[model samples]
Structure formats: structure tokens, C-alpha cells
Target: MKTQKLKFTFLVFIFSFSNLFSQYTEIINSNNPGFSESPYSVGSGVYQFESSFFLKNLSTNTPTSLDNSWGVDLAFRTSFFLERLEFDAALTFQRDRLLGNFTNAYTINSGLSKIMVGAKYLIFESTYKDKSKEIRSWKRRFAFDTKRLIPSIAVFAGVNTDFVSDVYKTNTVSPRIGILLQNELSNYFNVITNFFYDFIGTNFSEYQLTITGTYNFNDRWSWFLENQTIFQQNQTNTSFAGGLAFLFNKDLQINTSARFLREAGNNGSYITLGLSYRINRHVDSYKLLDENGNEIIDTPINRYNNKRKGFFNRIFSIFKKKNKGNKTRNRGKRKRNN
Candidate 1:
């Protein structure tokens, strides 16, 4: 009787372990092509600001704790005129608030926070550069190059620090490898996708895929869908967002988006207002490195550190092209008022 009981206990343990990890099956992202559609490549300059929020529905069976978190991201990049060489920096800040009908309530000052920085370079080039202009905006003709394999790939590694409480904290340097592909199936639509995987010590690895599609019906009106999934620790949550993008002119894009998130223990959803703007920057070649690097000065876009470049590059580039057309101006018919 004793021997039979011991065997039964061992079998129960194995089954439970297998059941917990079965949700690790991978998901391939389809909307990533939309995100990678802009042409601000390695040596070019680019800037973006984004904010997102995550809300959770707490469990009912027992006393549970959950958090609603908000985060902001600031990123800059420069391409070295080489198109395949560049450097970039992305900083993120996240704060969360927790509440429940329990004795211990959670607060933003002591929840969870994180920040990260890294670099990427190009290793391969695709012939997907032949693309059409957006219906209304001439400024974004080759906004995002569409290709399935961006092979001239780069590597990135960075340090992450998280604040959980005053007395306890976790700090580690984590590395990530990323691949992006963009595709154009026809004149009316474009697709883009980006895949990234992060390893955090013994914690379960995180895999995220972002996919989006941009459909242009005319010069002023466009439609888009954004899809994302966060896979970790034997669970996967997915969300879908759809929005209408209004392109008023070259300098601005006003977009409103509705979002939804679904997972095993929680369901989340939110609506957001998104604005994307472009401030043109013209710069020289790239060769400036931050504190830590092997080839630190990687891209043309990230080197806005010099105020001199920020002021003169834009003013000079706009008129420089016109100077080349001076001969054409001289040859064209002109009636003198003399």
C-alpha cells in the first residue's frame, strides 16, 4: 500500500508541471510591417513619444493583488548617410497603482518601475526600397521600407533597473536580438512586423510581436490596425487596436485608437489619443559614442547631442537642394519687370 501511494504522488507532480508550461507555444505577428514602414533608417534622424496603460481585473476566488500601470518612452536615432550604420537610445519609465478590498493596499511610490538603453546596426539590405508615396503627404514617400528579411542585422544589450520597494530592488543587464520585416502587397496597403525576445535572469523570457497595417483611401484619410502579444511565464496575452489616421499635412498625424487585452486570469482594455510629428533634421556623418560601446557611434539619427547639428542641419538641407536647381531656374522662361 505504501509503495503504491508514493508512485501516485510522483505522477501527480509531473502532470502539474507539464500543465503549467503548456501555454508556451509561440505566436507569429502579422502587423509588424506597419511599424517598420518608415524610412528613417540607420544614418537618418528620428524621434518619437509614446504612452500606454495596462489595467487588470482582480481575481475573485481569494484575496488577490493586481496593478494598473502607465509608461512613457522617448527614443532618438541617426543614420550616418551610409543607410546601414546608426545608433539609438530608448528610455522607458513605468509606474503602477494597486488597490483591493484587503488590509494591504498598493501605491505607485512602491509598485514597479523599469528603464533600459541599447544600440542596433544594420547587416543586410533588401531591394524593397521601391515604394509609392502616401496619398496626401510627399514627405513620407519611403517612410518604411518593406522587406521580409532585414539580414544586415544588428545586436543590442542594455542594463535594466526596477524599483519594487524602498528596502528591496533588482538590477540586471539584459540583452535582446530583434528582426523586422516590411512588405507591400499592392498600392493601397502596407504591412510591417517586429519580433523581440528578452531574457531576464531565471525569470521566464519575454517575447513580444507588434504588427500593423496602413491602408490609404485618399490623401487625407487612412485606416490602420495594430496587434500585439506579450508571452511570458507560461501565459500569453494578446490585444487588438484599430484606428483612423488623419494626415493633415507633412508635419503632423492625428490618430485616435481603441485597445483591448485578453489573457488567462485577466482582461484589459483602454482607448488612447496618439499624435506623431516630424521635425526634419539634416546632419553630417556618424561617429559619436556614449559611455559604453565597441562600435558605439552606430547610426546617423541618434547624434542630436550636438546643438550645432540640430540648428544648422535642417536650415541648410532644405535650401541646399534648391541650389542644385539654379541652372534650371536660369534656363526657364522669366519675364523681367525692367
Candidate 2:
């Protein structure tokens, strides 16, 4: 009986440990092929790269009548100090051809369009109850978890540099800040939202909001729909995009997306082909557990300094103490009988 009880306690402790470190997953988490970003970070010690190549066409009713552009967007992401924190850099380079409305002459321009360095730190994370553990009723197992309504939130701050081509250079370095939110509605569906203020204290400042929804068809196939809006001093721009992604393996993904844009004086569209890959070198920290499934500090000083304990550990410690008391009583009774 004691042996069986110890085995059960060990299994429970293992399950709880995995649940506590849920931020890390075996698969790579990439934010790509969409304008919005996820609040979750690539797990600590993982390096990820995402890139997209695109062609764009725009028609305006103003002086510049028609514009054709091709661009490549590149991003590098990595996490280090904490599982909830990530650092990233992004770059965009584009070539554009503009047609004059009156003269019908073409003007060509090419250069780096954007460069930014940023960091994201998760502030709040919500955990939902595991419905799969329910064995009594199917309804309970399949019911929606209300905790899904509360999103995991992260904050992002970045600096935009003036190191770009003359055509798109701001001449002034500026700051950007944003809030990212994500809700995992189910095993197959997720929604992410981002609100950003870009080019702070600059003449070309803007506010951007993006919402993206993704649905997984299976382990390897997924699709996403996104809408992004930019609010500027003079006019507002909006875009709608949809895409599909295929996971070639745990560390690589390929995707394609198309976006339609509407601005104050121009209508534009772009198609993107993207790839995401990661180098995962994450290692879990070691923990020590006692026979009754309680985490044990190896040193007396460490045990004295740590006060908080897991709920399961506290509950099992009570049973462990009670069992010891029962053993003492049994031994006393045998002595009295002798």
C-alpha cells in the first residue's frame, strides 16, 4: 500500500511540474506571415528567424498615380534571461517605381525602408483548467473554459533608426511602443491583438492596431485572417489579409499571404511568401522532490528562505505526517500486546 501511494504521488508531482513550466513547448513558436505579433515569446535559449518577400501595387488619385513596389522583410528573434522575455530586430528594404499623373513619366526609388530593434516581455499569463482530466461526464470534458476570456498580455518597446535610404529616411531616431494580447480560445483556435504607437515625437507619427485570428486544421496545417489599421494625422489606412501556413517540421514553417489595402487616396494590394525557422537549445531546470511529492530544498538555508510551496505538496505533506503517526501508534500497540 505504501509503495503504491508513493508511486501515485510521484506521478502527480511530475504532472504538476510540467504544467508549471507551460511557457516552453517542444515546437517552435513563430510570429510571421502576418502583421500582428503573438504575446508569447520563443522559449528561452531559442533563436528564430522569419522573413517574407512581397510585391505590391498601389493606385492613387493624386500626383503619383500608380506605384509598383517589391520588398523583403526580415526579422530575428531570441530569448535569454527569462522564458517570458524576447528580443528582436526587423529590417525592410524596398524598390518603388512611381508614375506621374500629368507627365506619365516613371520615377524610380530604392533603399532600406525600415529598421528597428525591440524587446517583448510578457506581463500577465492566464492558465485554464485541464478538461481532459475529467472522466465522469463528456459534457464537462468538452465545455468551454471561461478563463479563456482573459488574455495573456505582453509589452513591447523599440527604437527606430534613421539609417535608411534617402527616399524613406526620417533623419530623426524615434521610439515605438505597443501592447500585445493573445487569447487561446481552444486547442485549434487562437486570437492575437496588437496596439502600437510608432515614430514617437516625429512628423510621421502613427497609431496602428492589428487583430489576427488563426485556426489549426491539424498538426501541420493552419490558416490565419488579419486586419490592420493605421491612424495618422491626415488620413487612415486599413488592410485585410489572409494566409495559410504549413509546418514542415517542428522547427520550420512556410507560408503565403495576400493583403488588400485601402487608404485615403490610394488602393493597394500585396502578396507575400514567407519562411520561419528556429534553432532550439532550450534546457529545463532541475528540481528535487521528496518521496511524498513535495519539492525539497537541498540546503537548510535554502529551505528556510523559500516559504511558498505548491498546493499539492502541502496536501500530500499532511497525508505523509498522518501516515507516520499511524505507524507510531501501531508500533506502540504491538509493544503493549507483548
- Going through the candidates in the order shown, the clash numbers are 36, 0
Q: Which candidate number would show the highest TM-score if scored against the true structure?
A: 2
Worst lDDT 10-window in candidate 1: 24-33
Can you write out model 2's per-residue Cα lDDT over 100-159, one digit (the tens) per residue? 767768888889999999999999997898888899999999999999999999999999
| Cα RMSD (angstroms) for every candidate in the order listed | 23.3, 12.1
> What is each predicted model's overall lDDT from 0 to 1?
0.51, 0.88
- Over the stretch 92-117, how does candidate 1's per-residue lDDT look in tens digits? 45555555456465544333344555
Model 1, which residues run further than 4 Å from truth? 1-64, 101-106, 109-112, 128-169, 200-202, 283-338
Off by over 4 Å in 2: 5-9, 291-294, 299-338
Estimate the TM-score for candidate 1.
Answer: 0.55
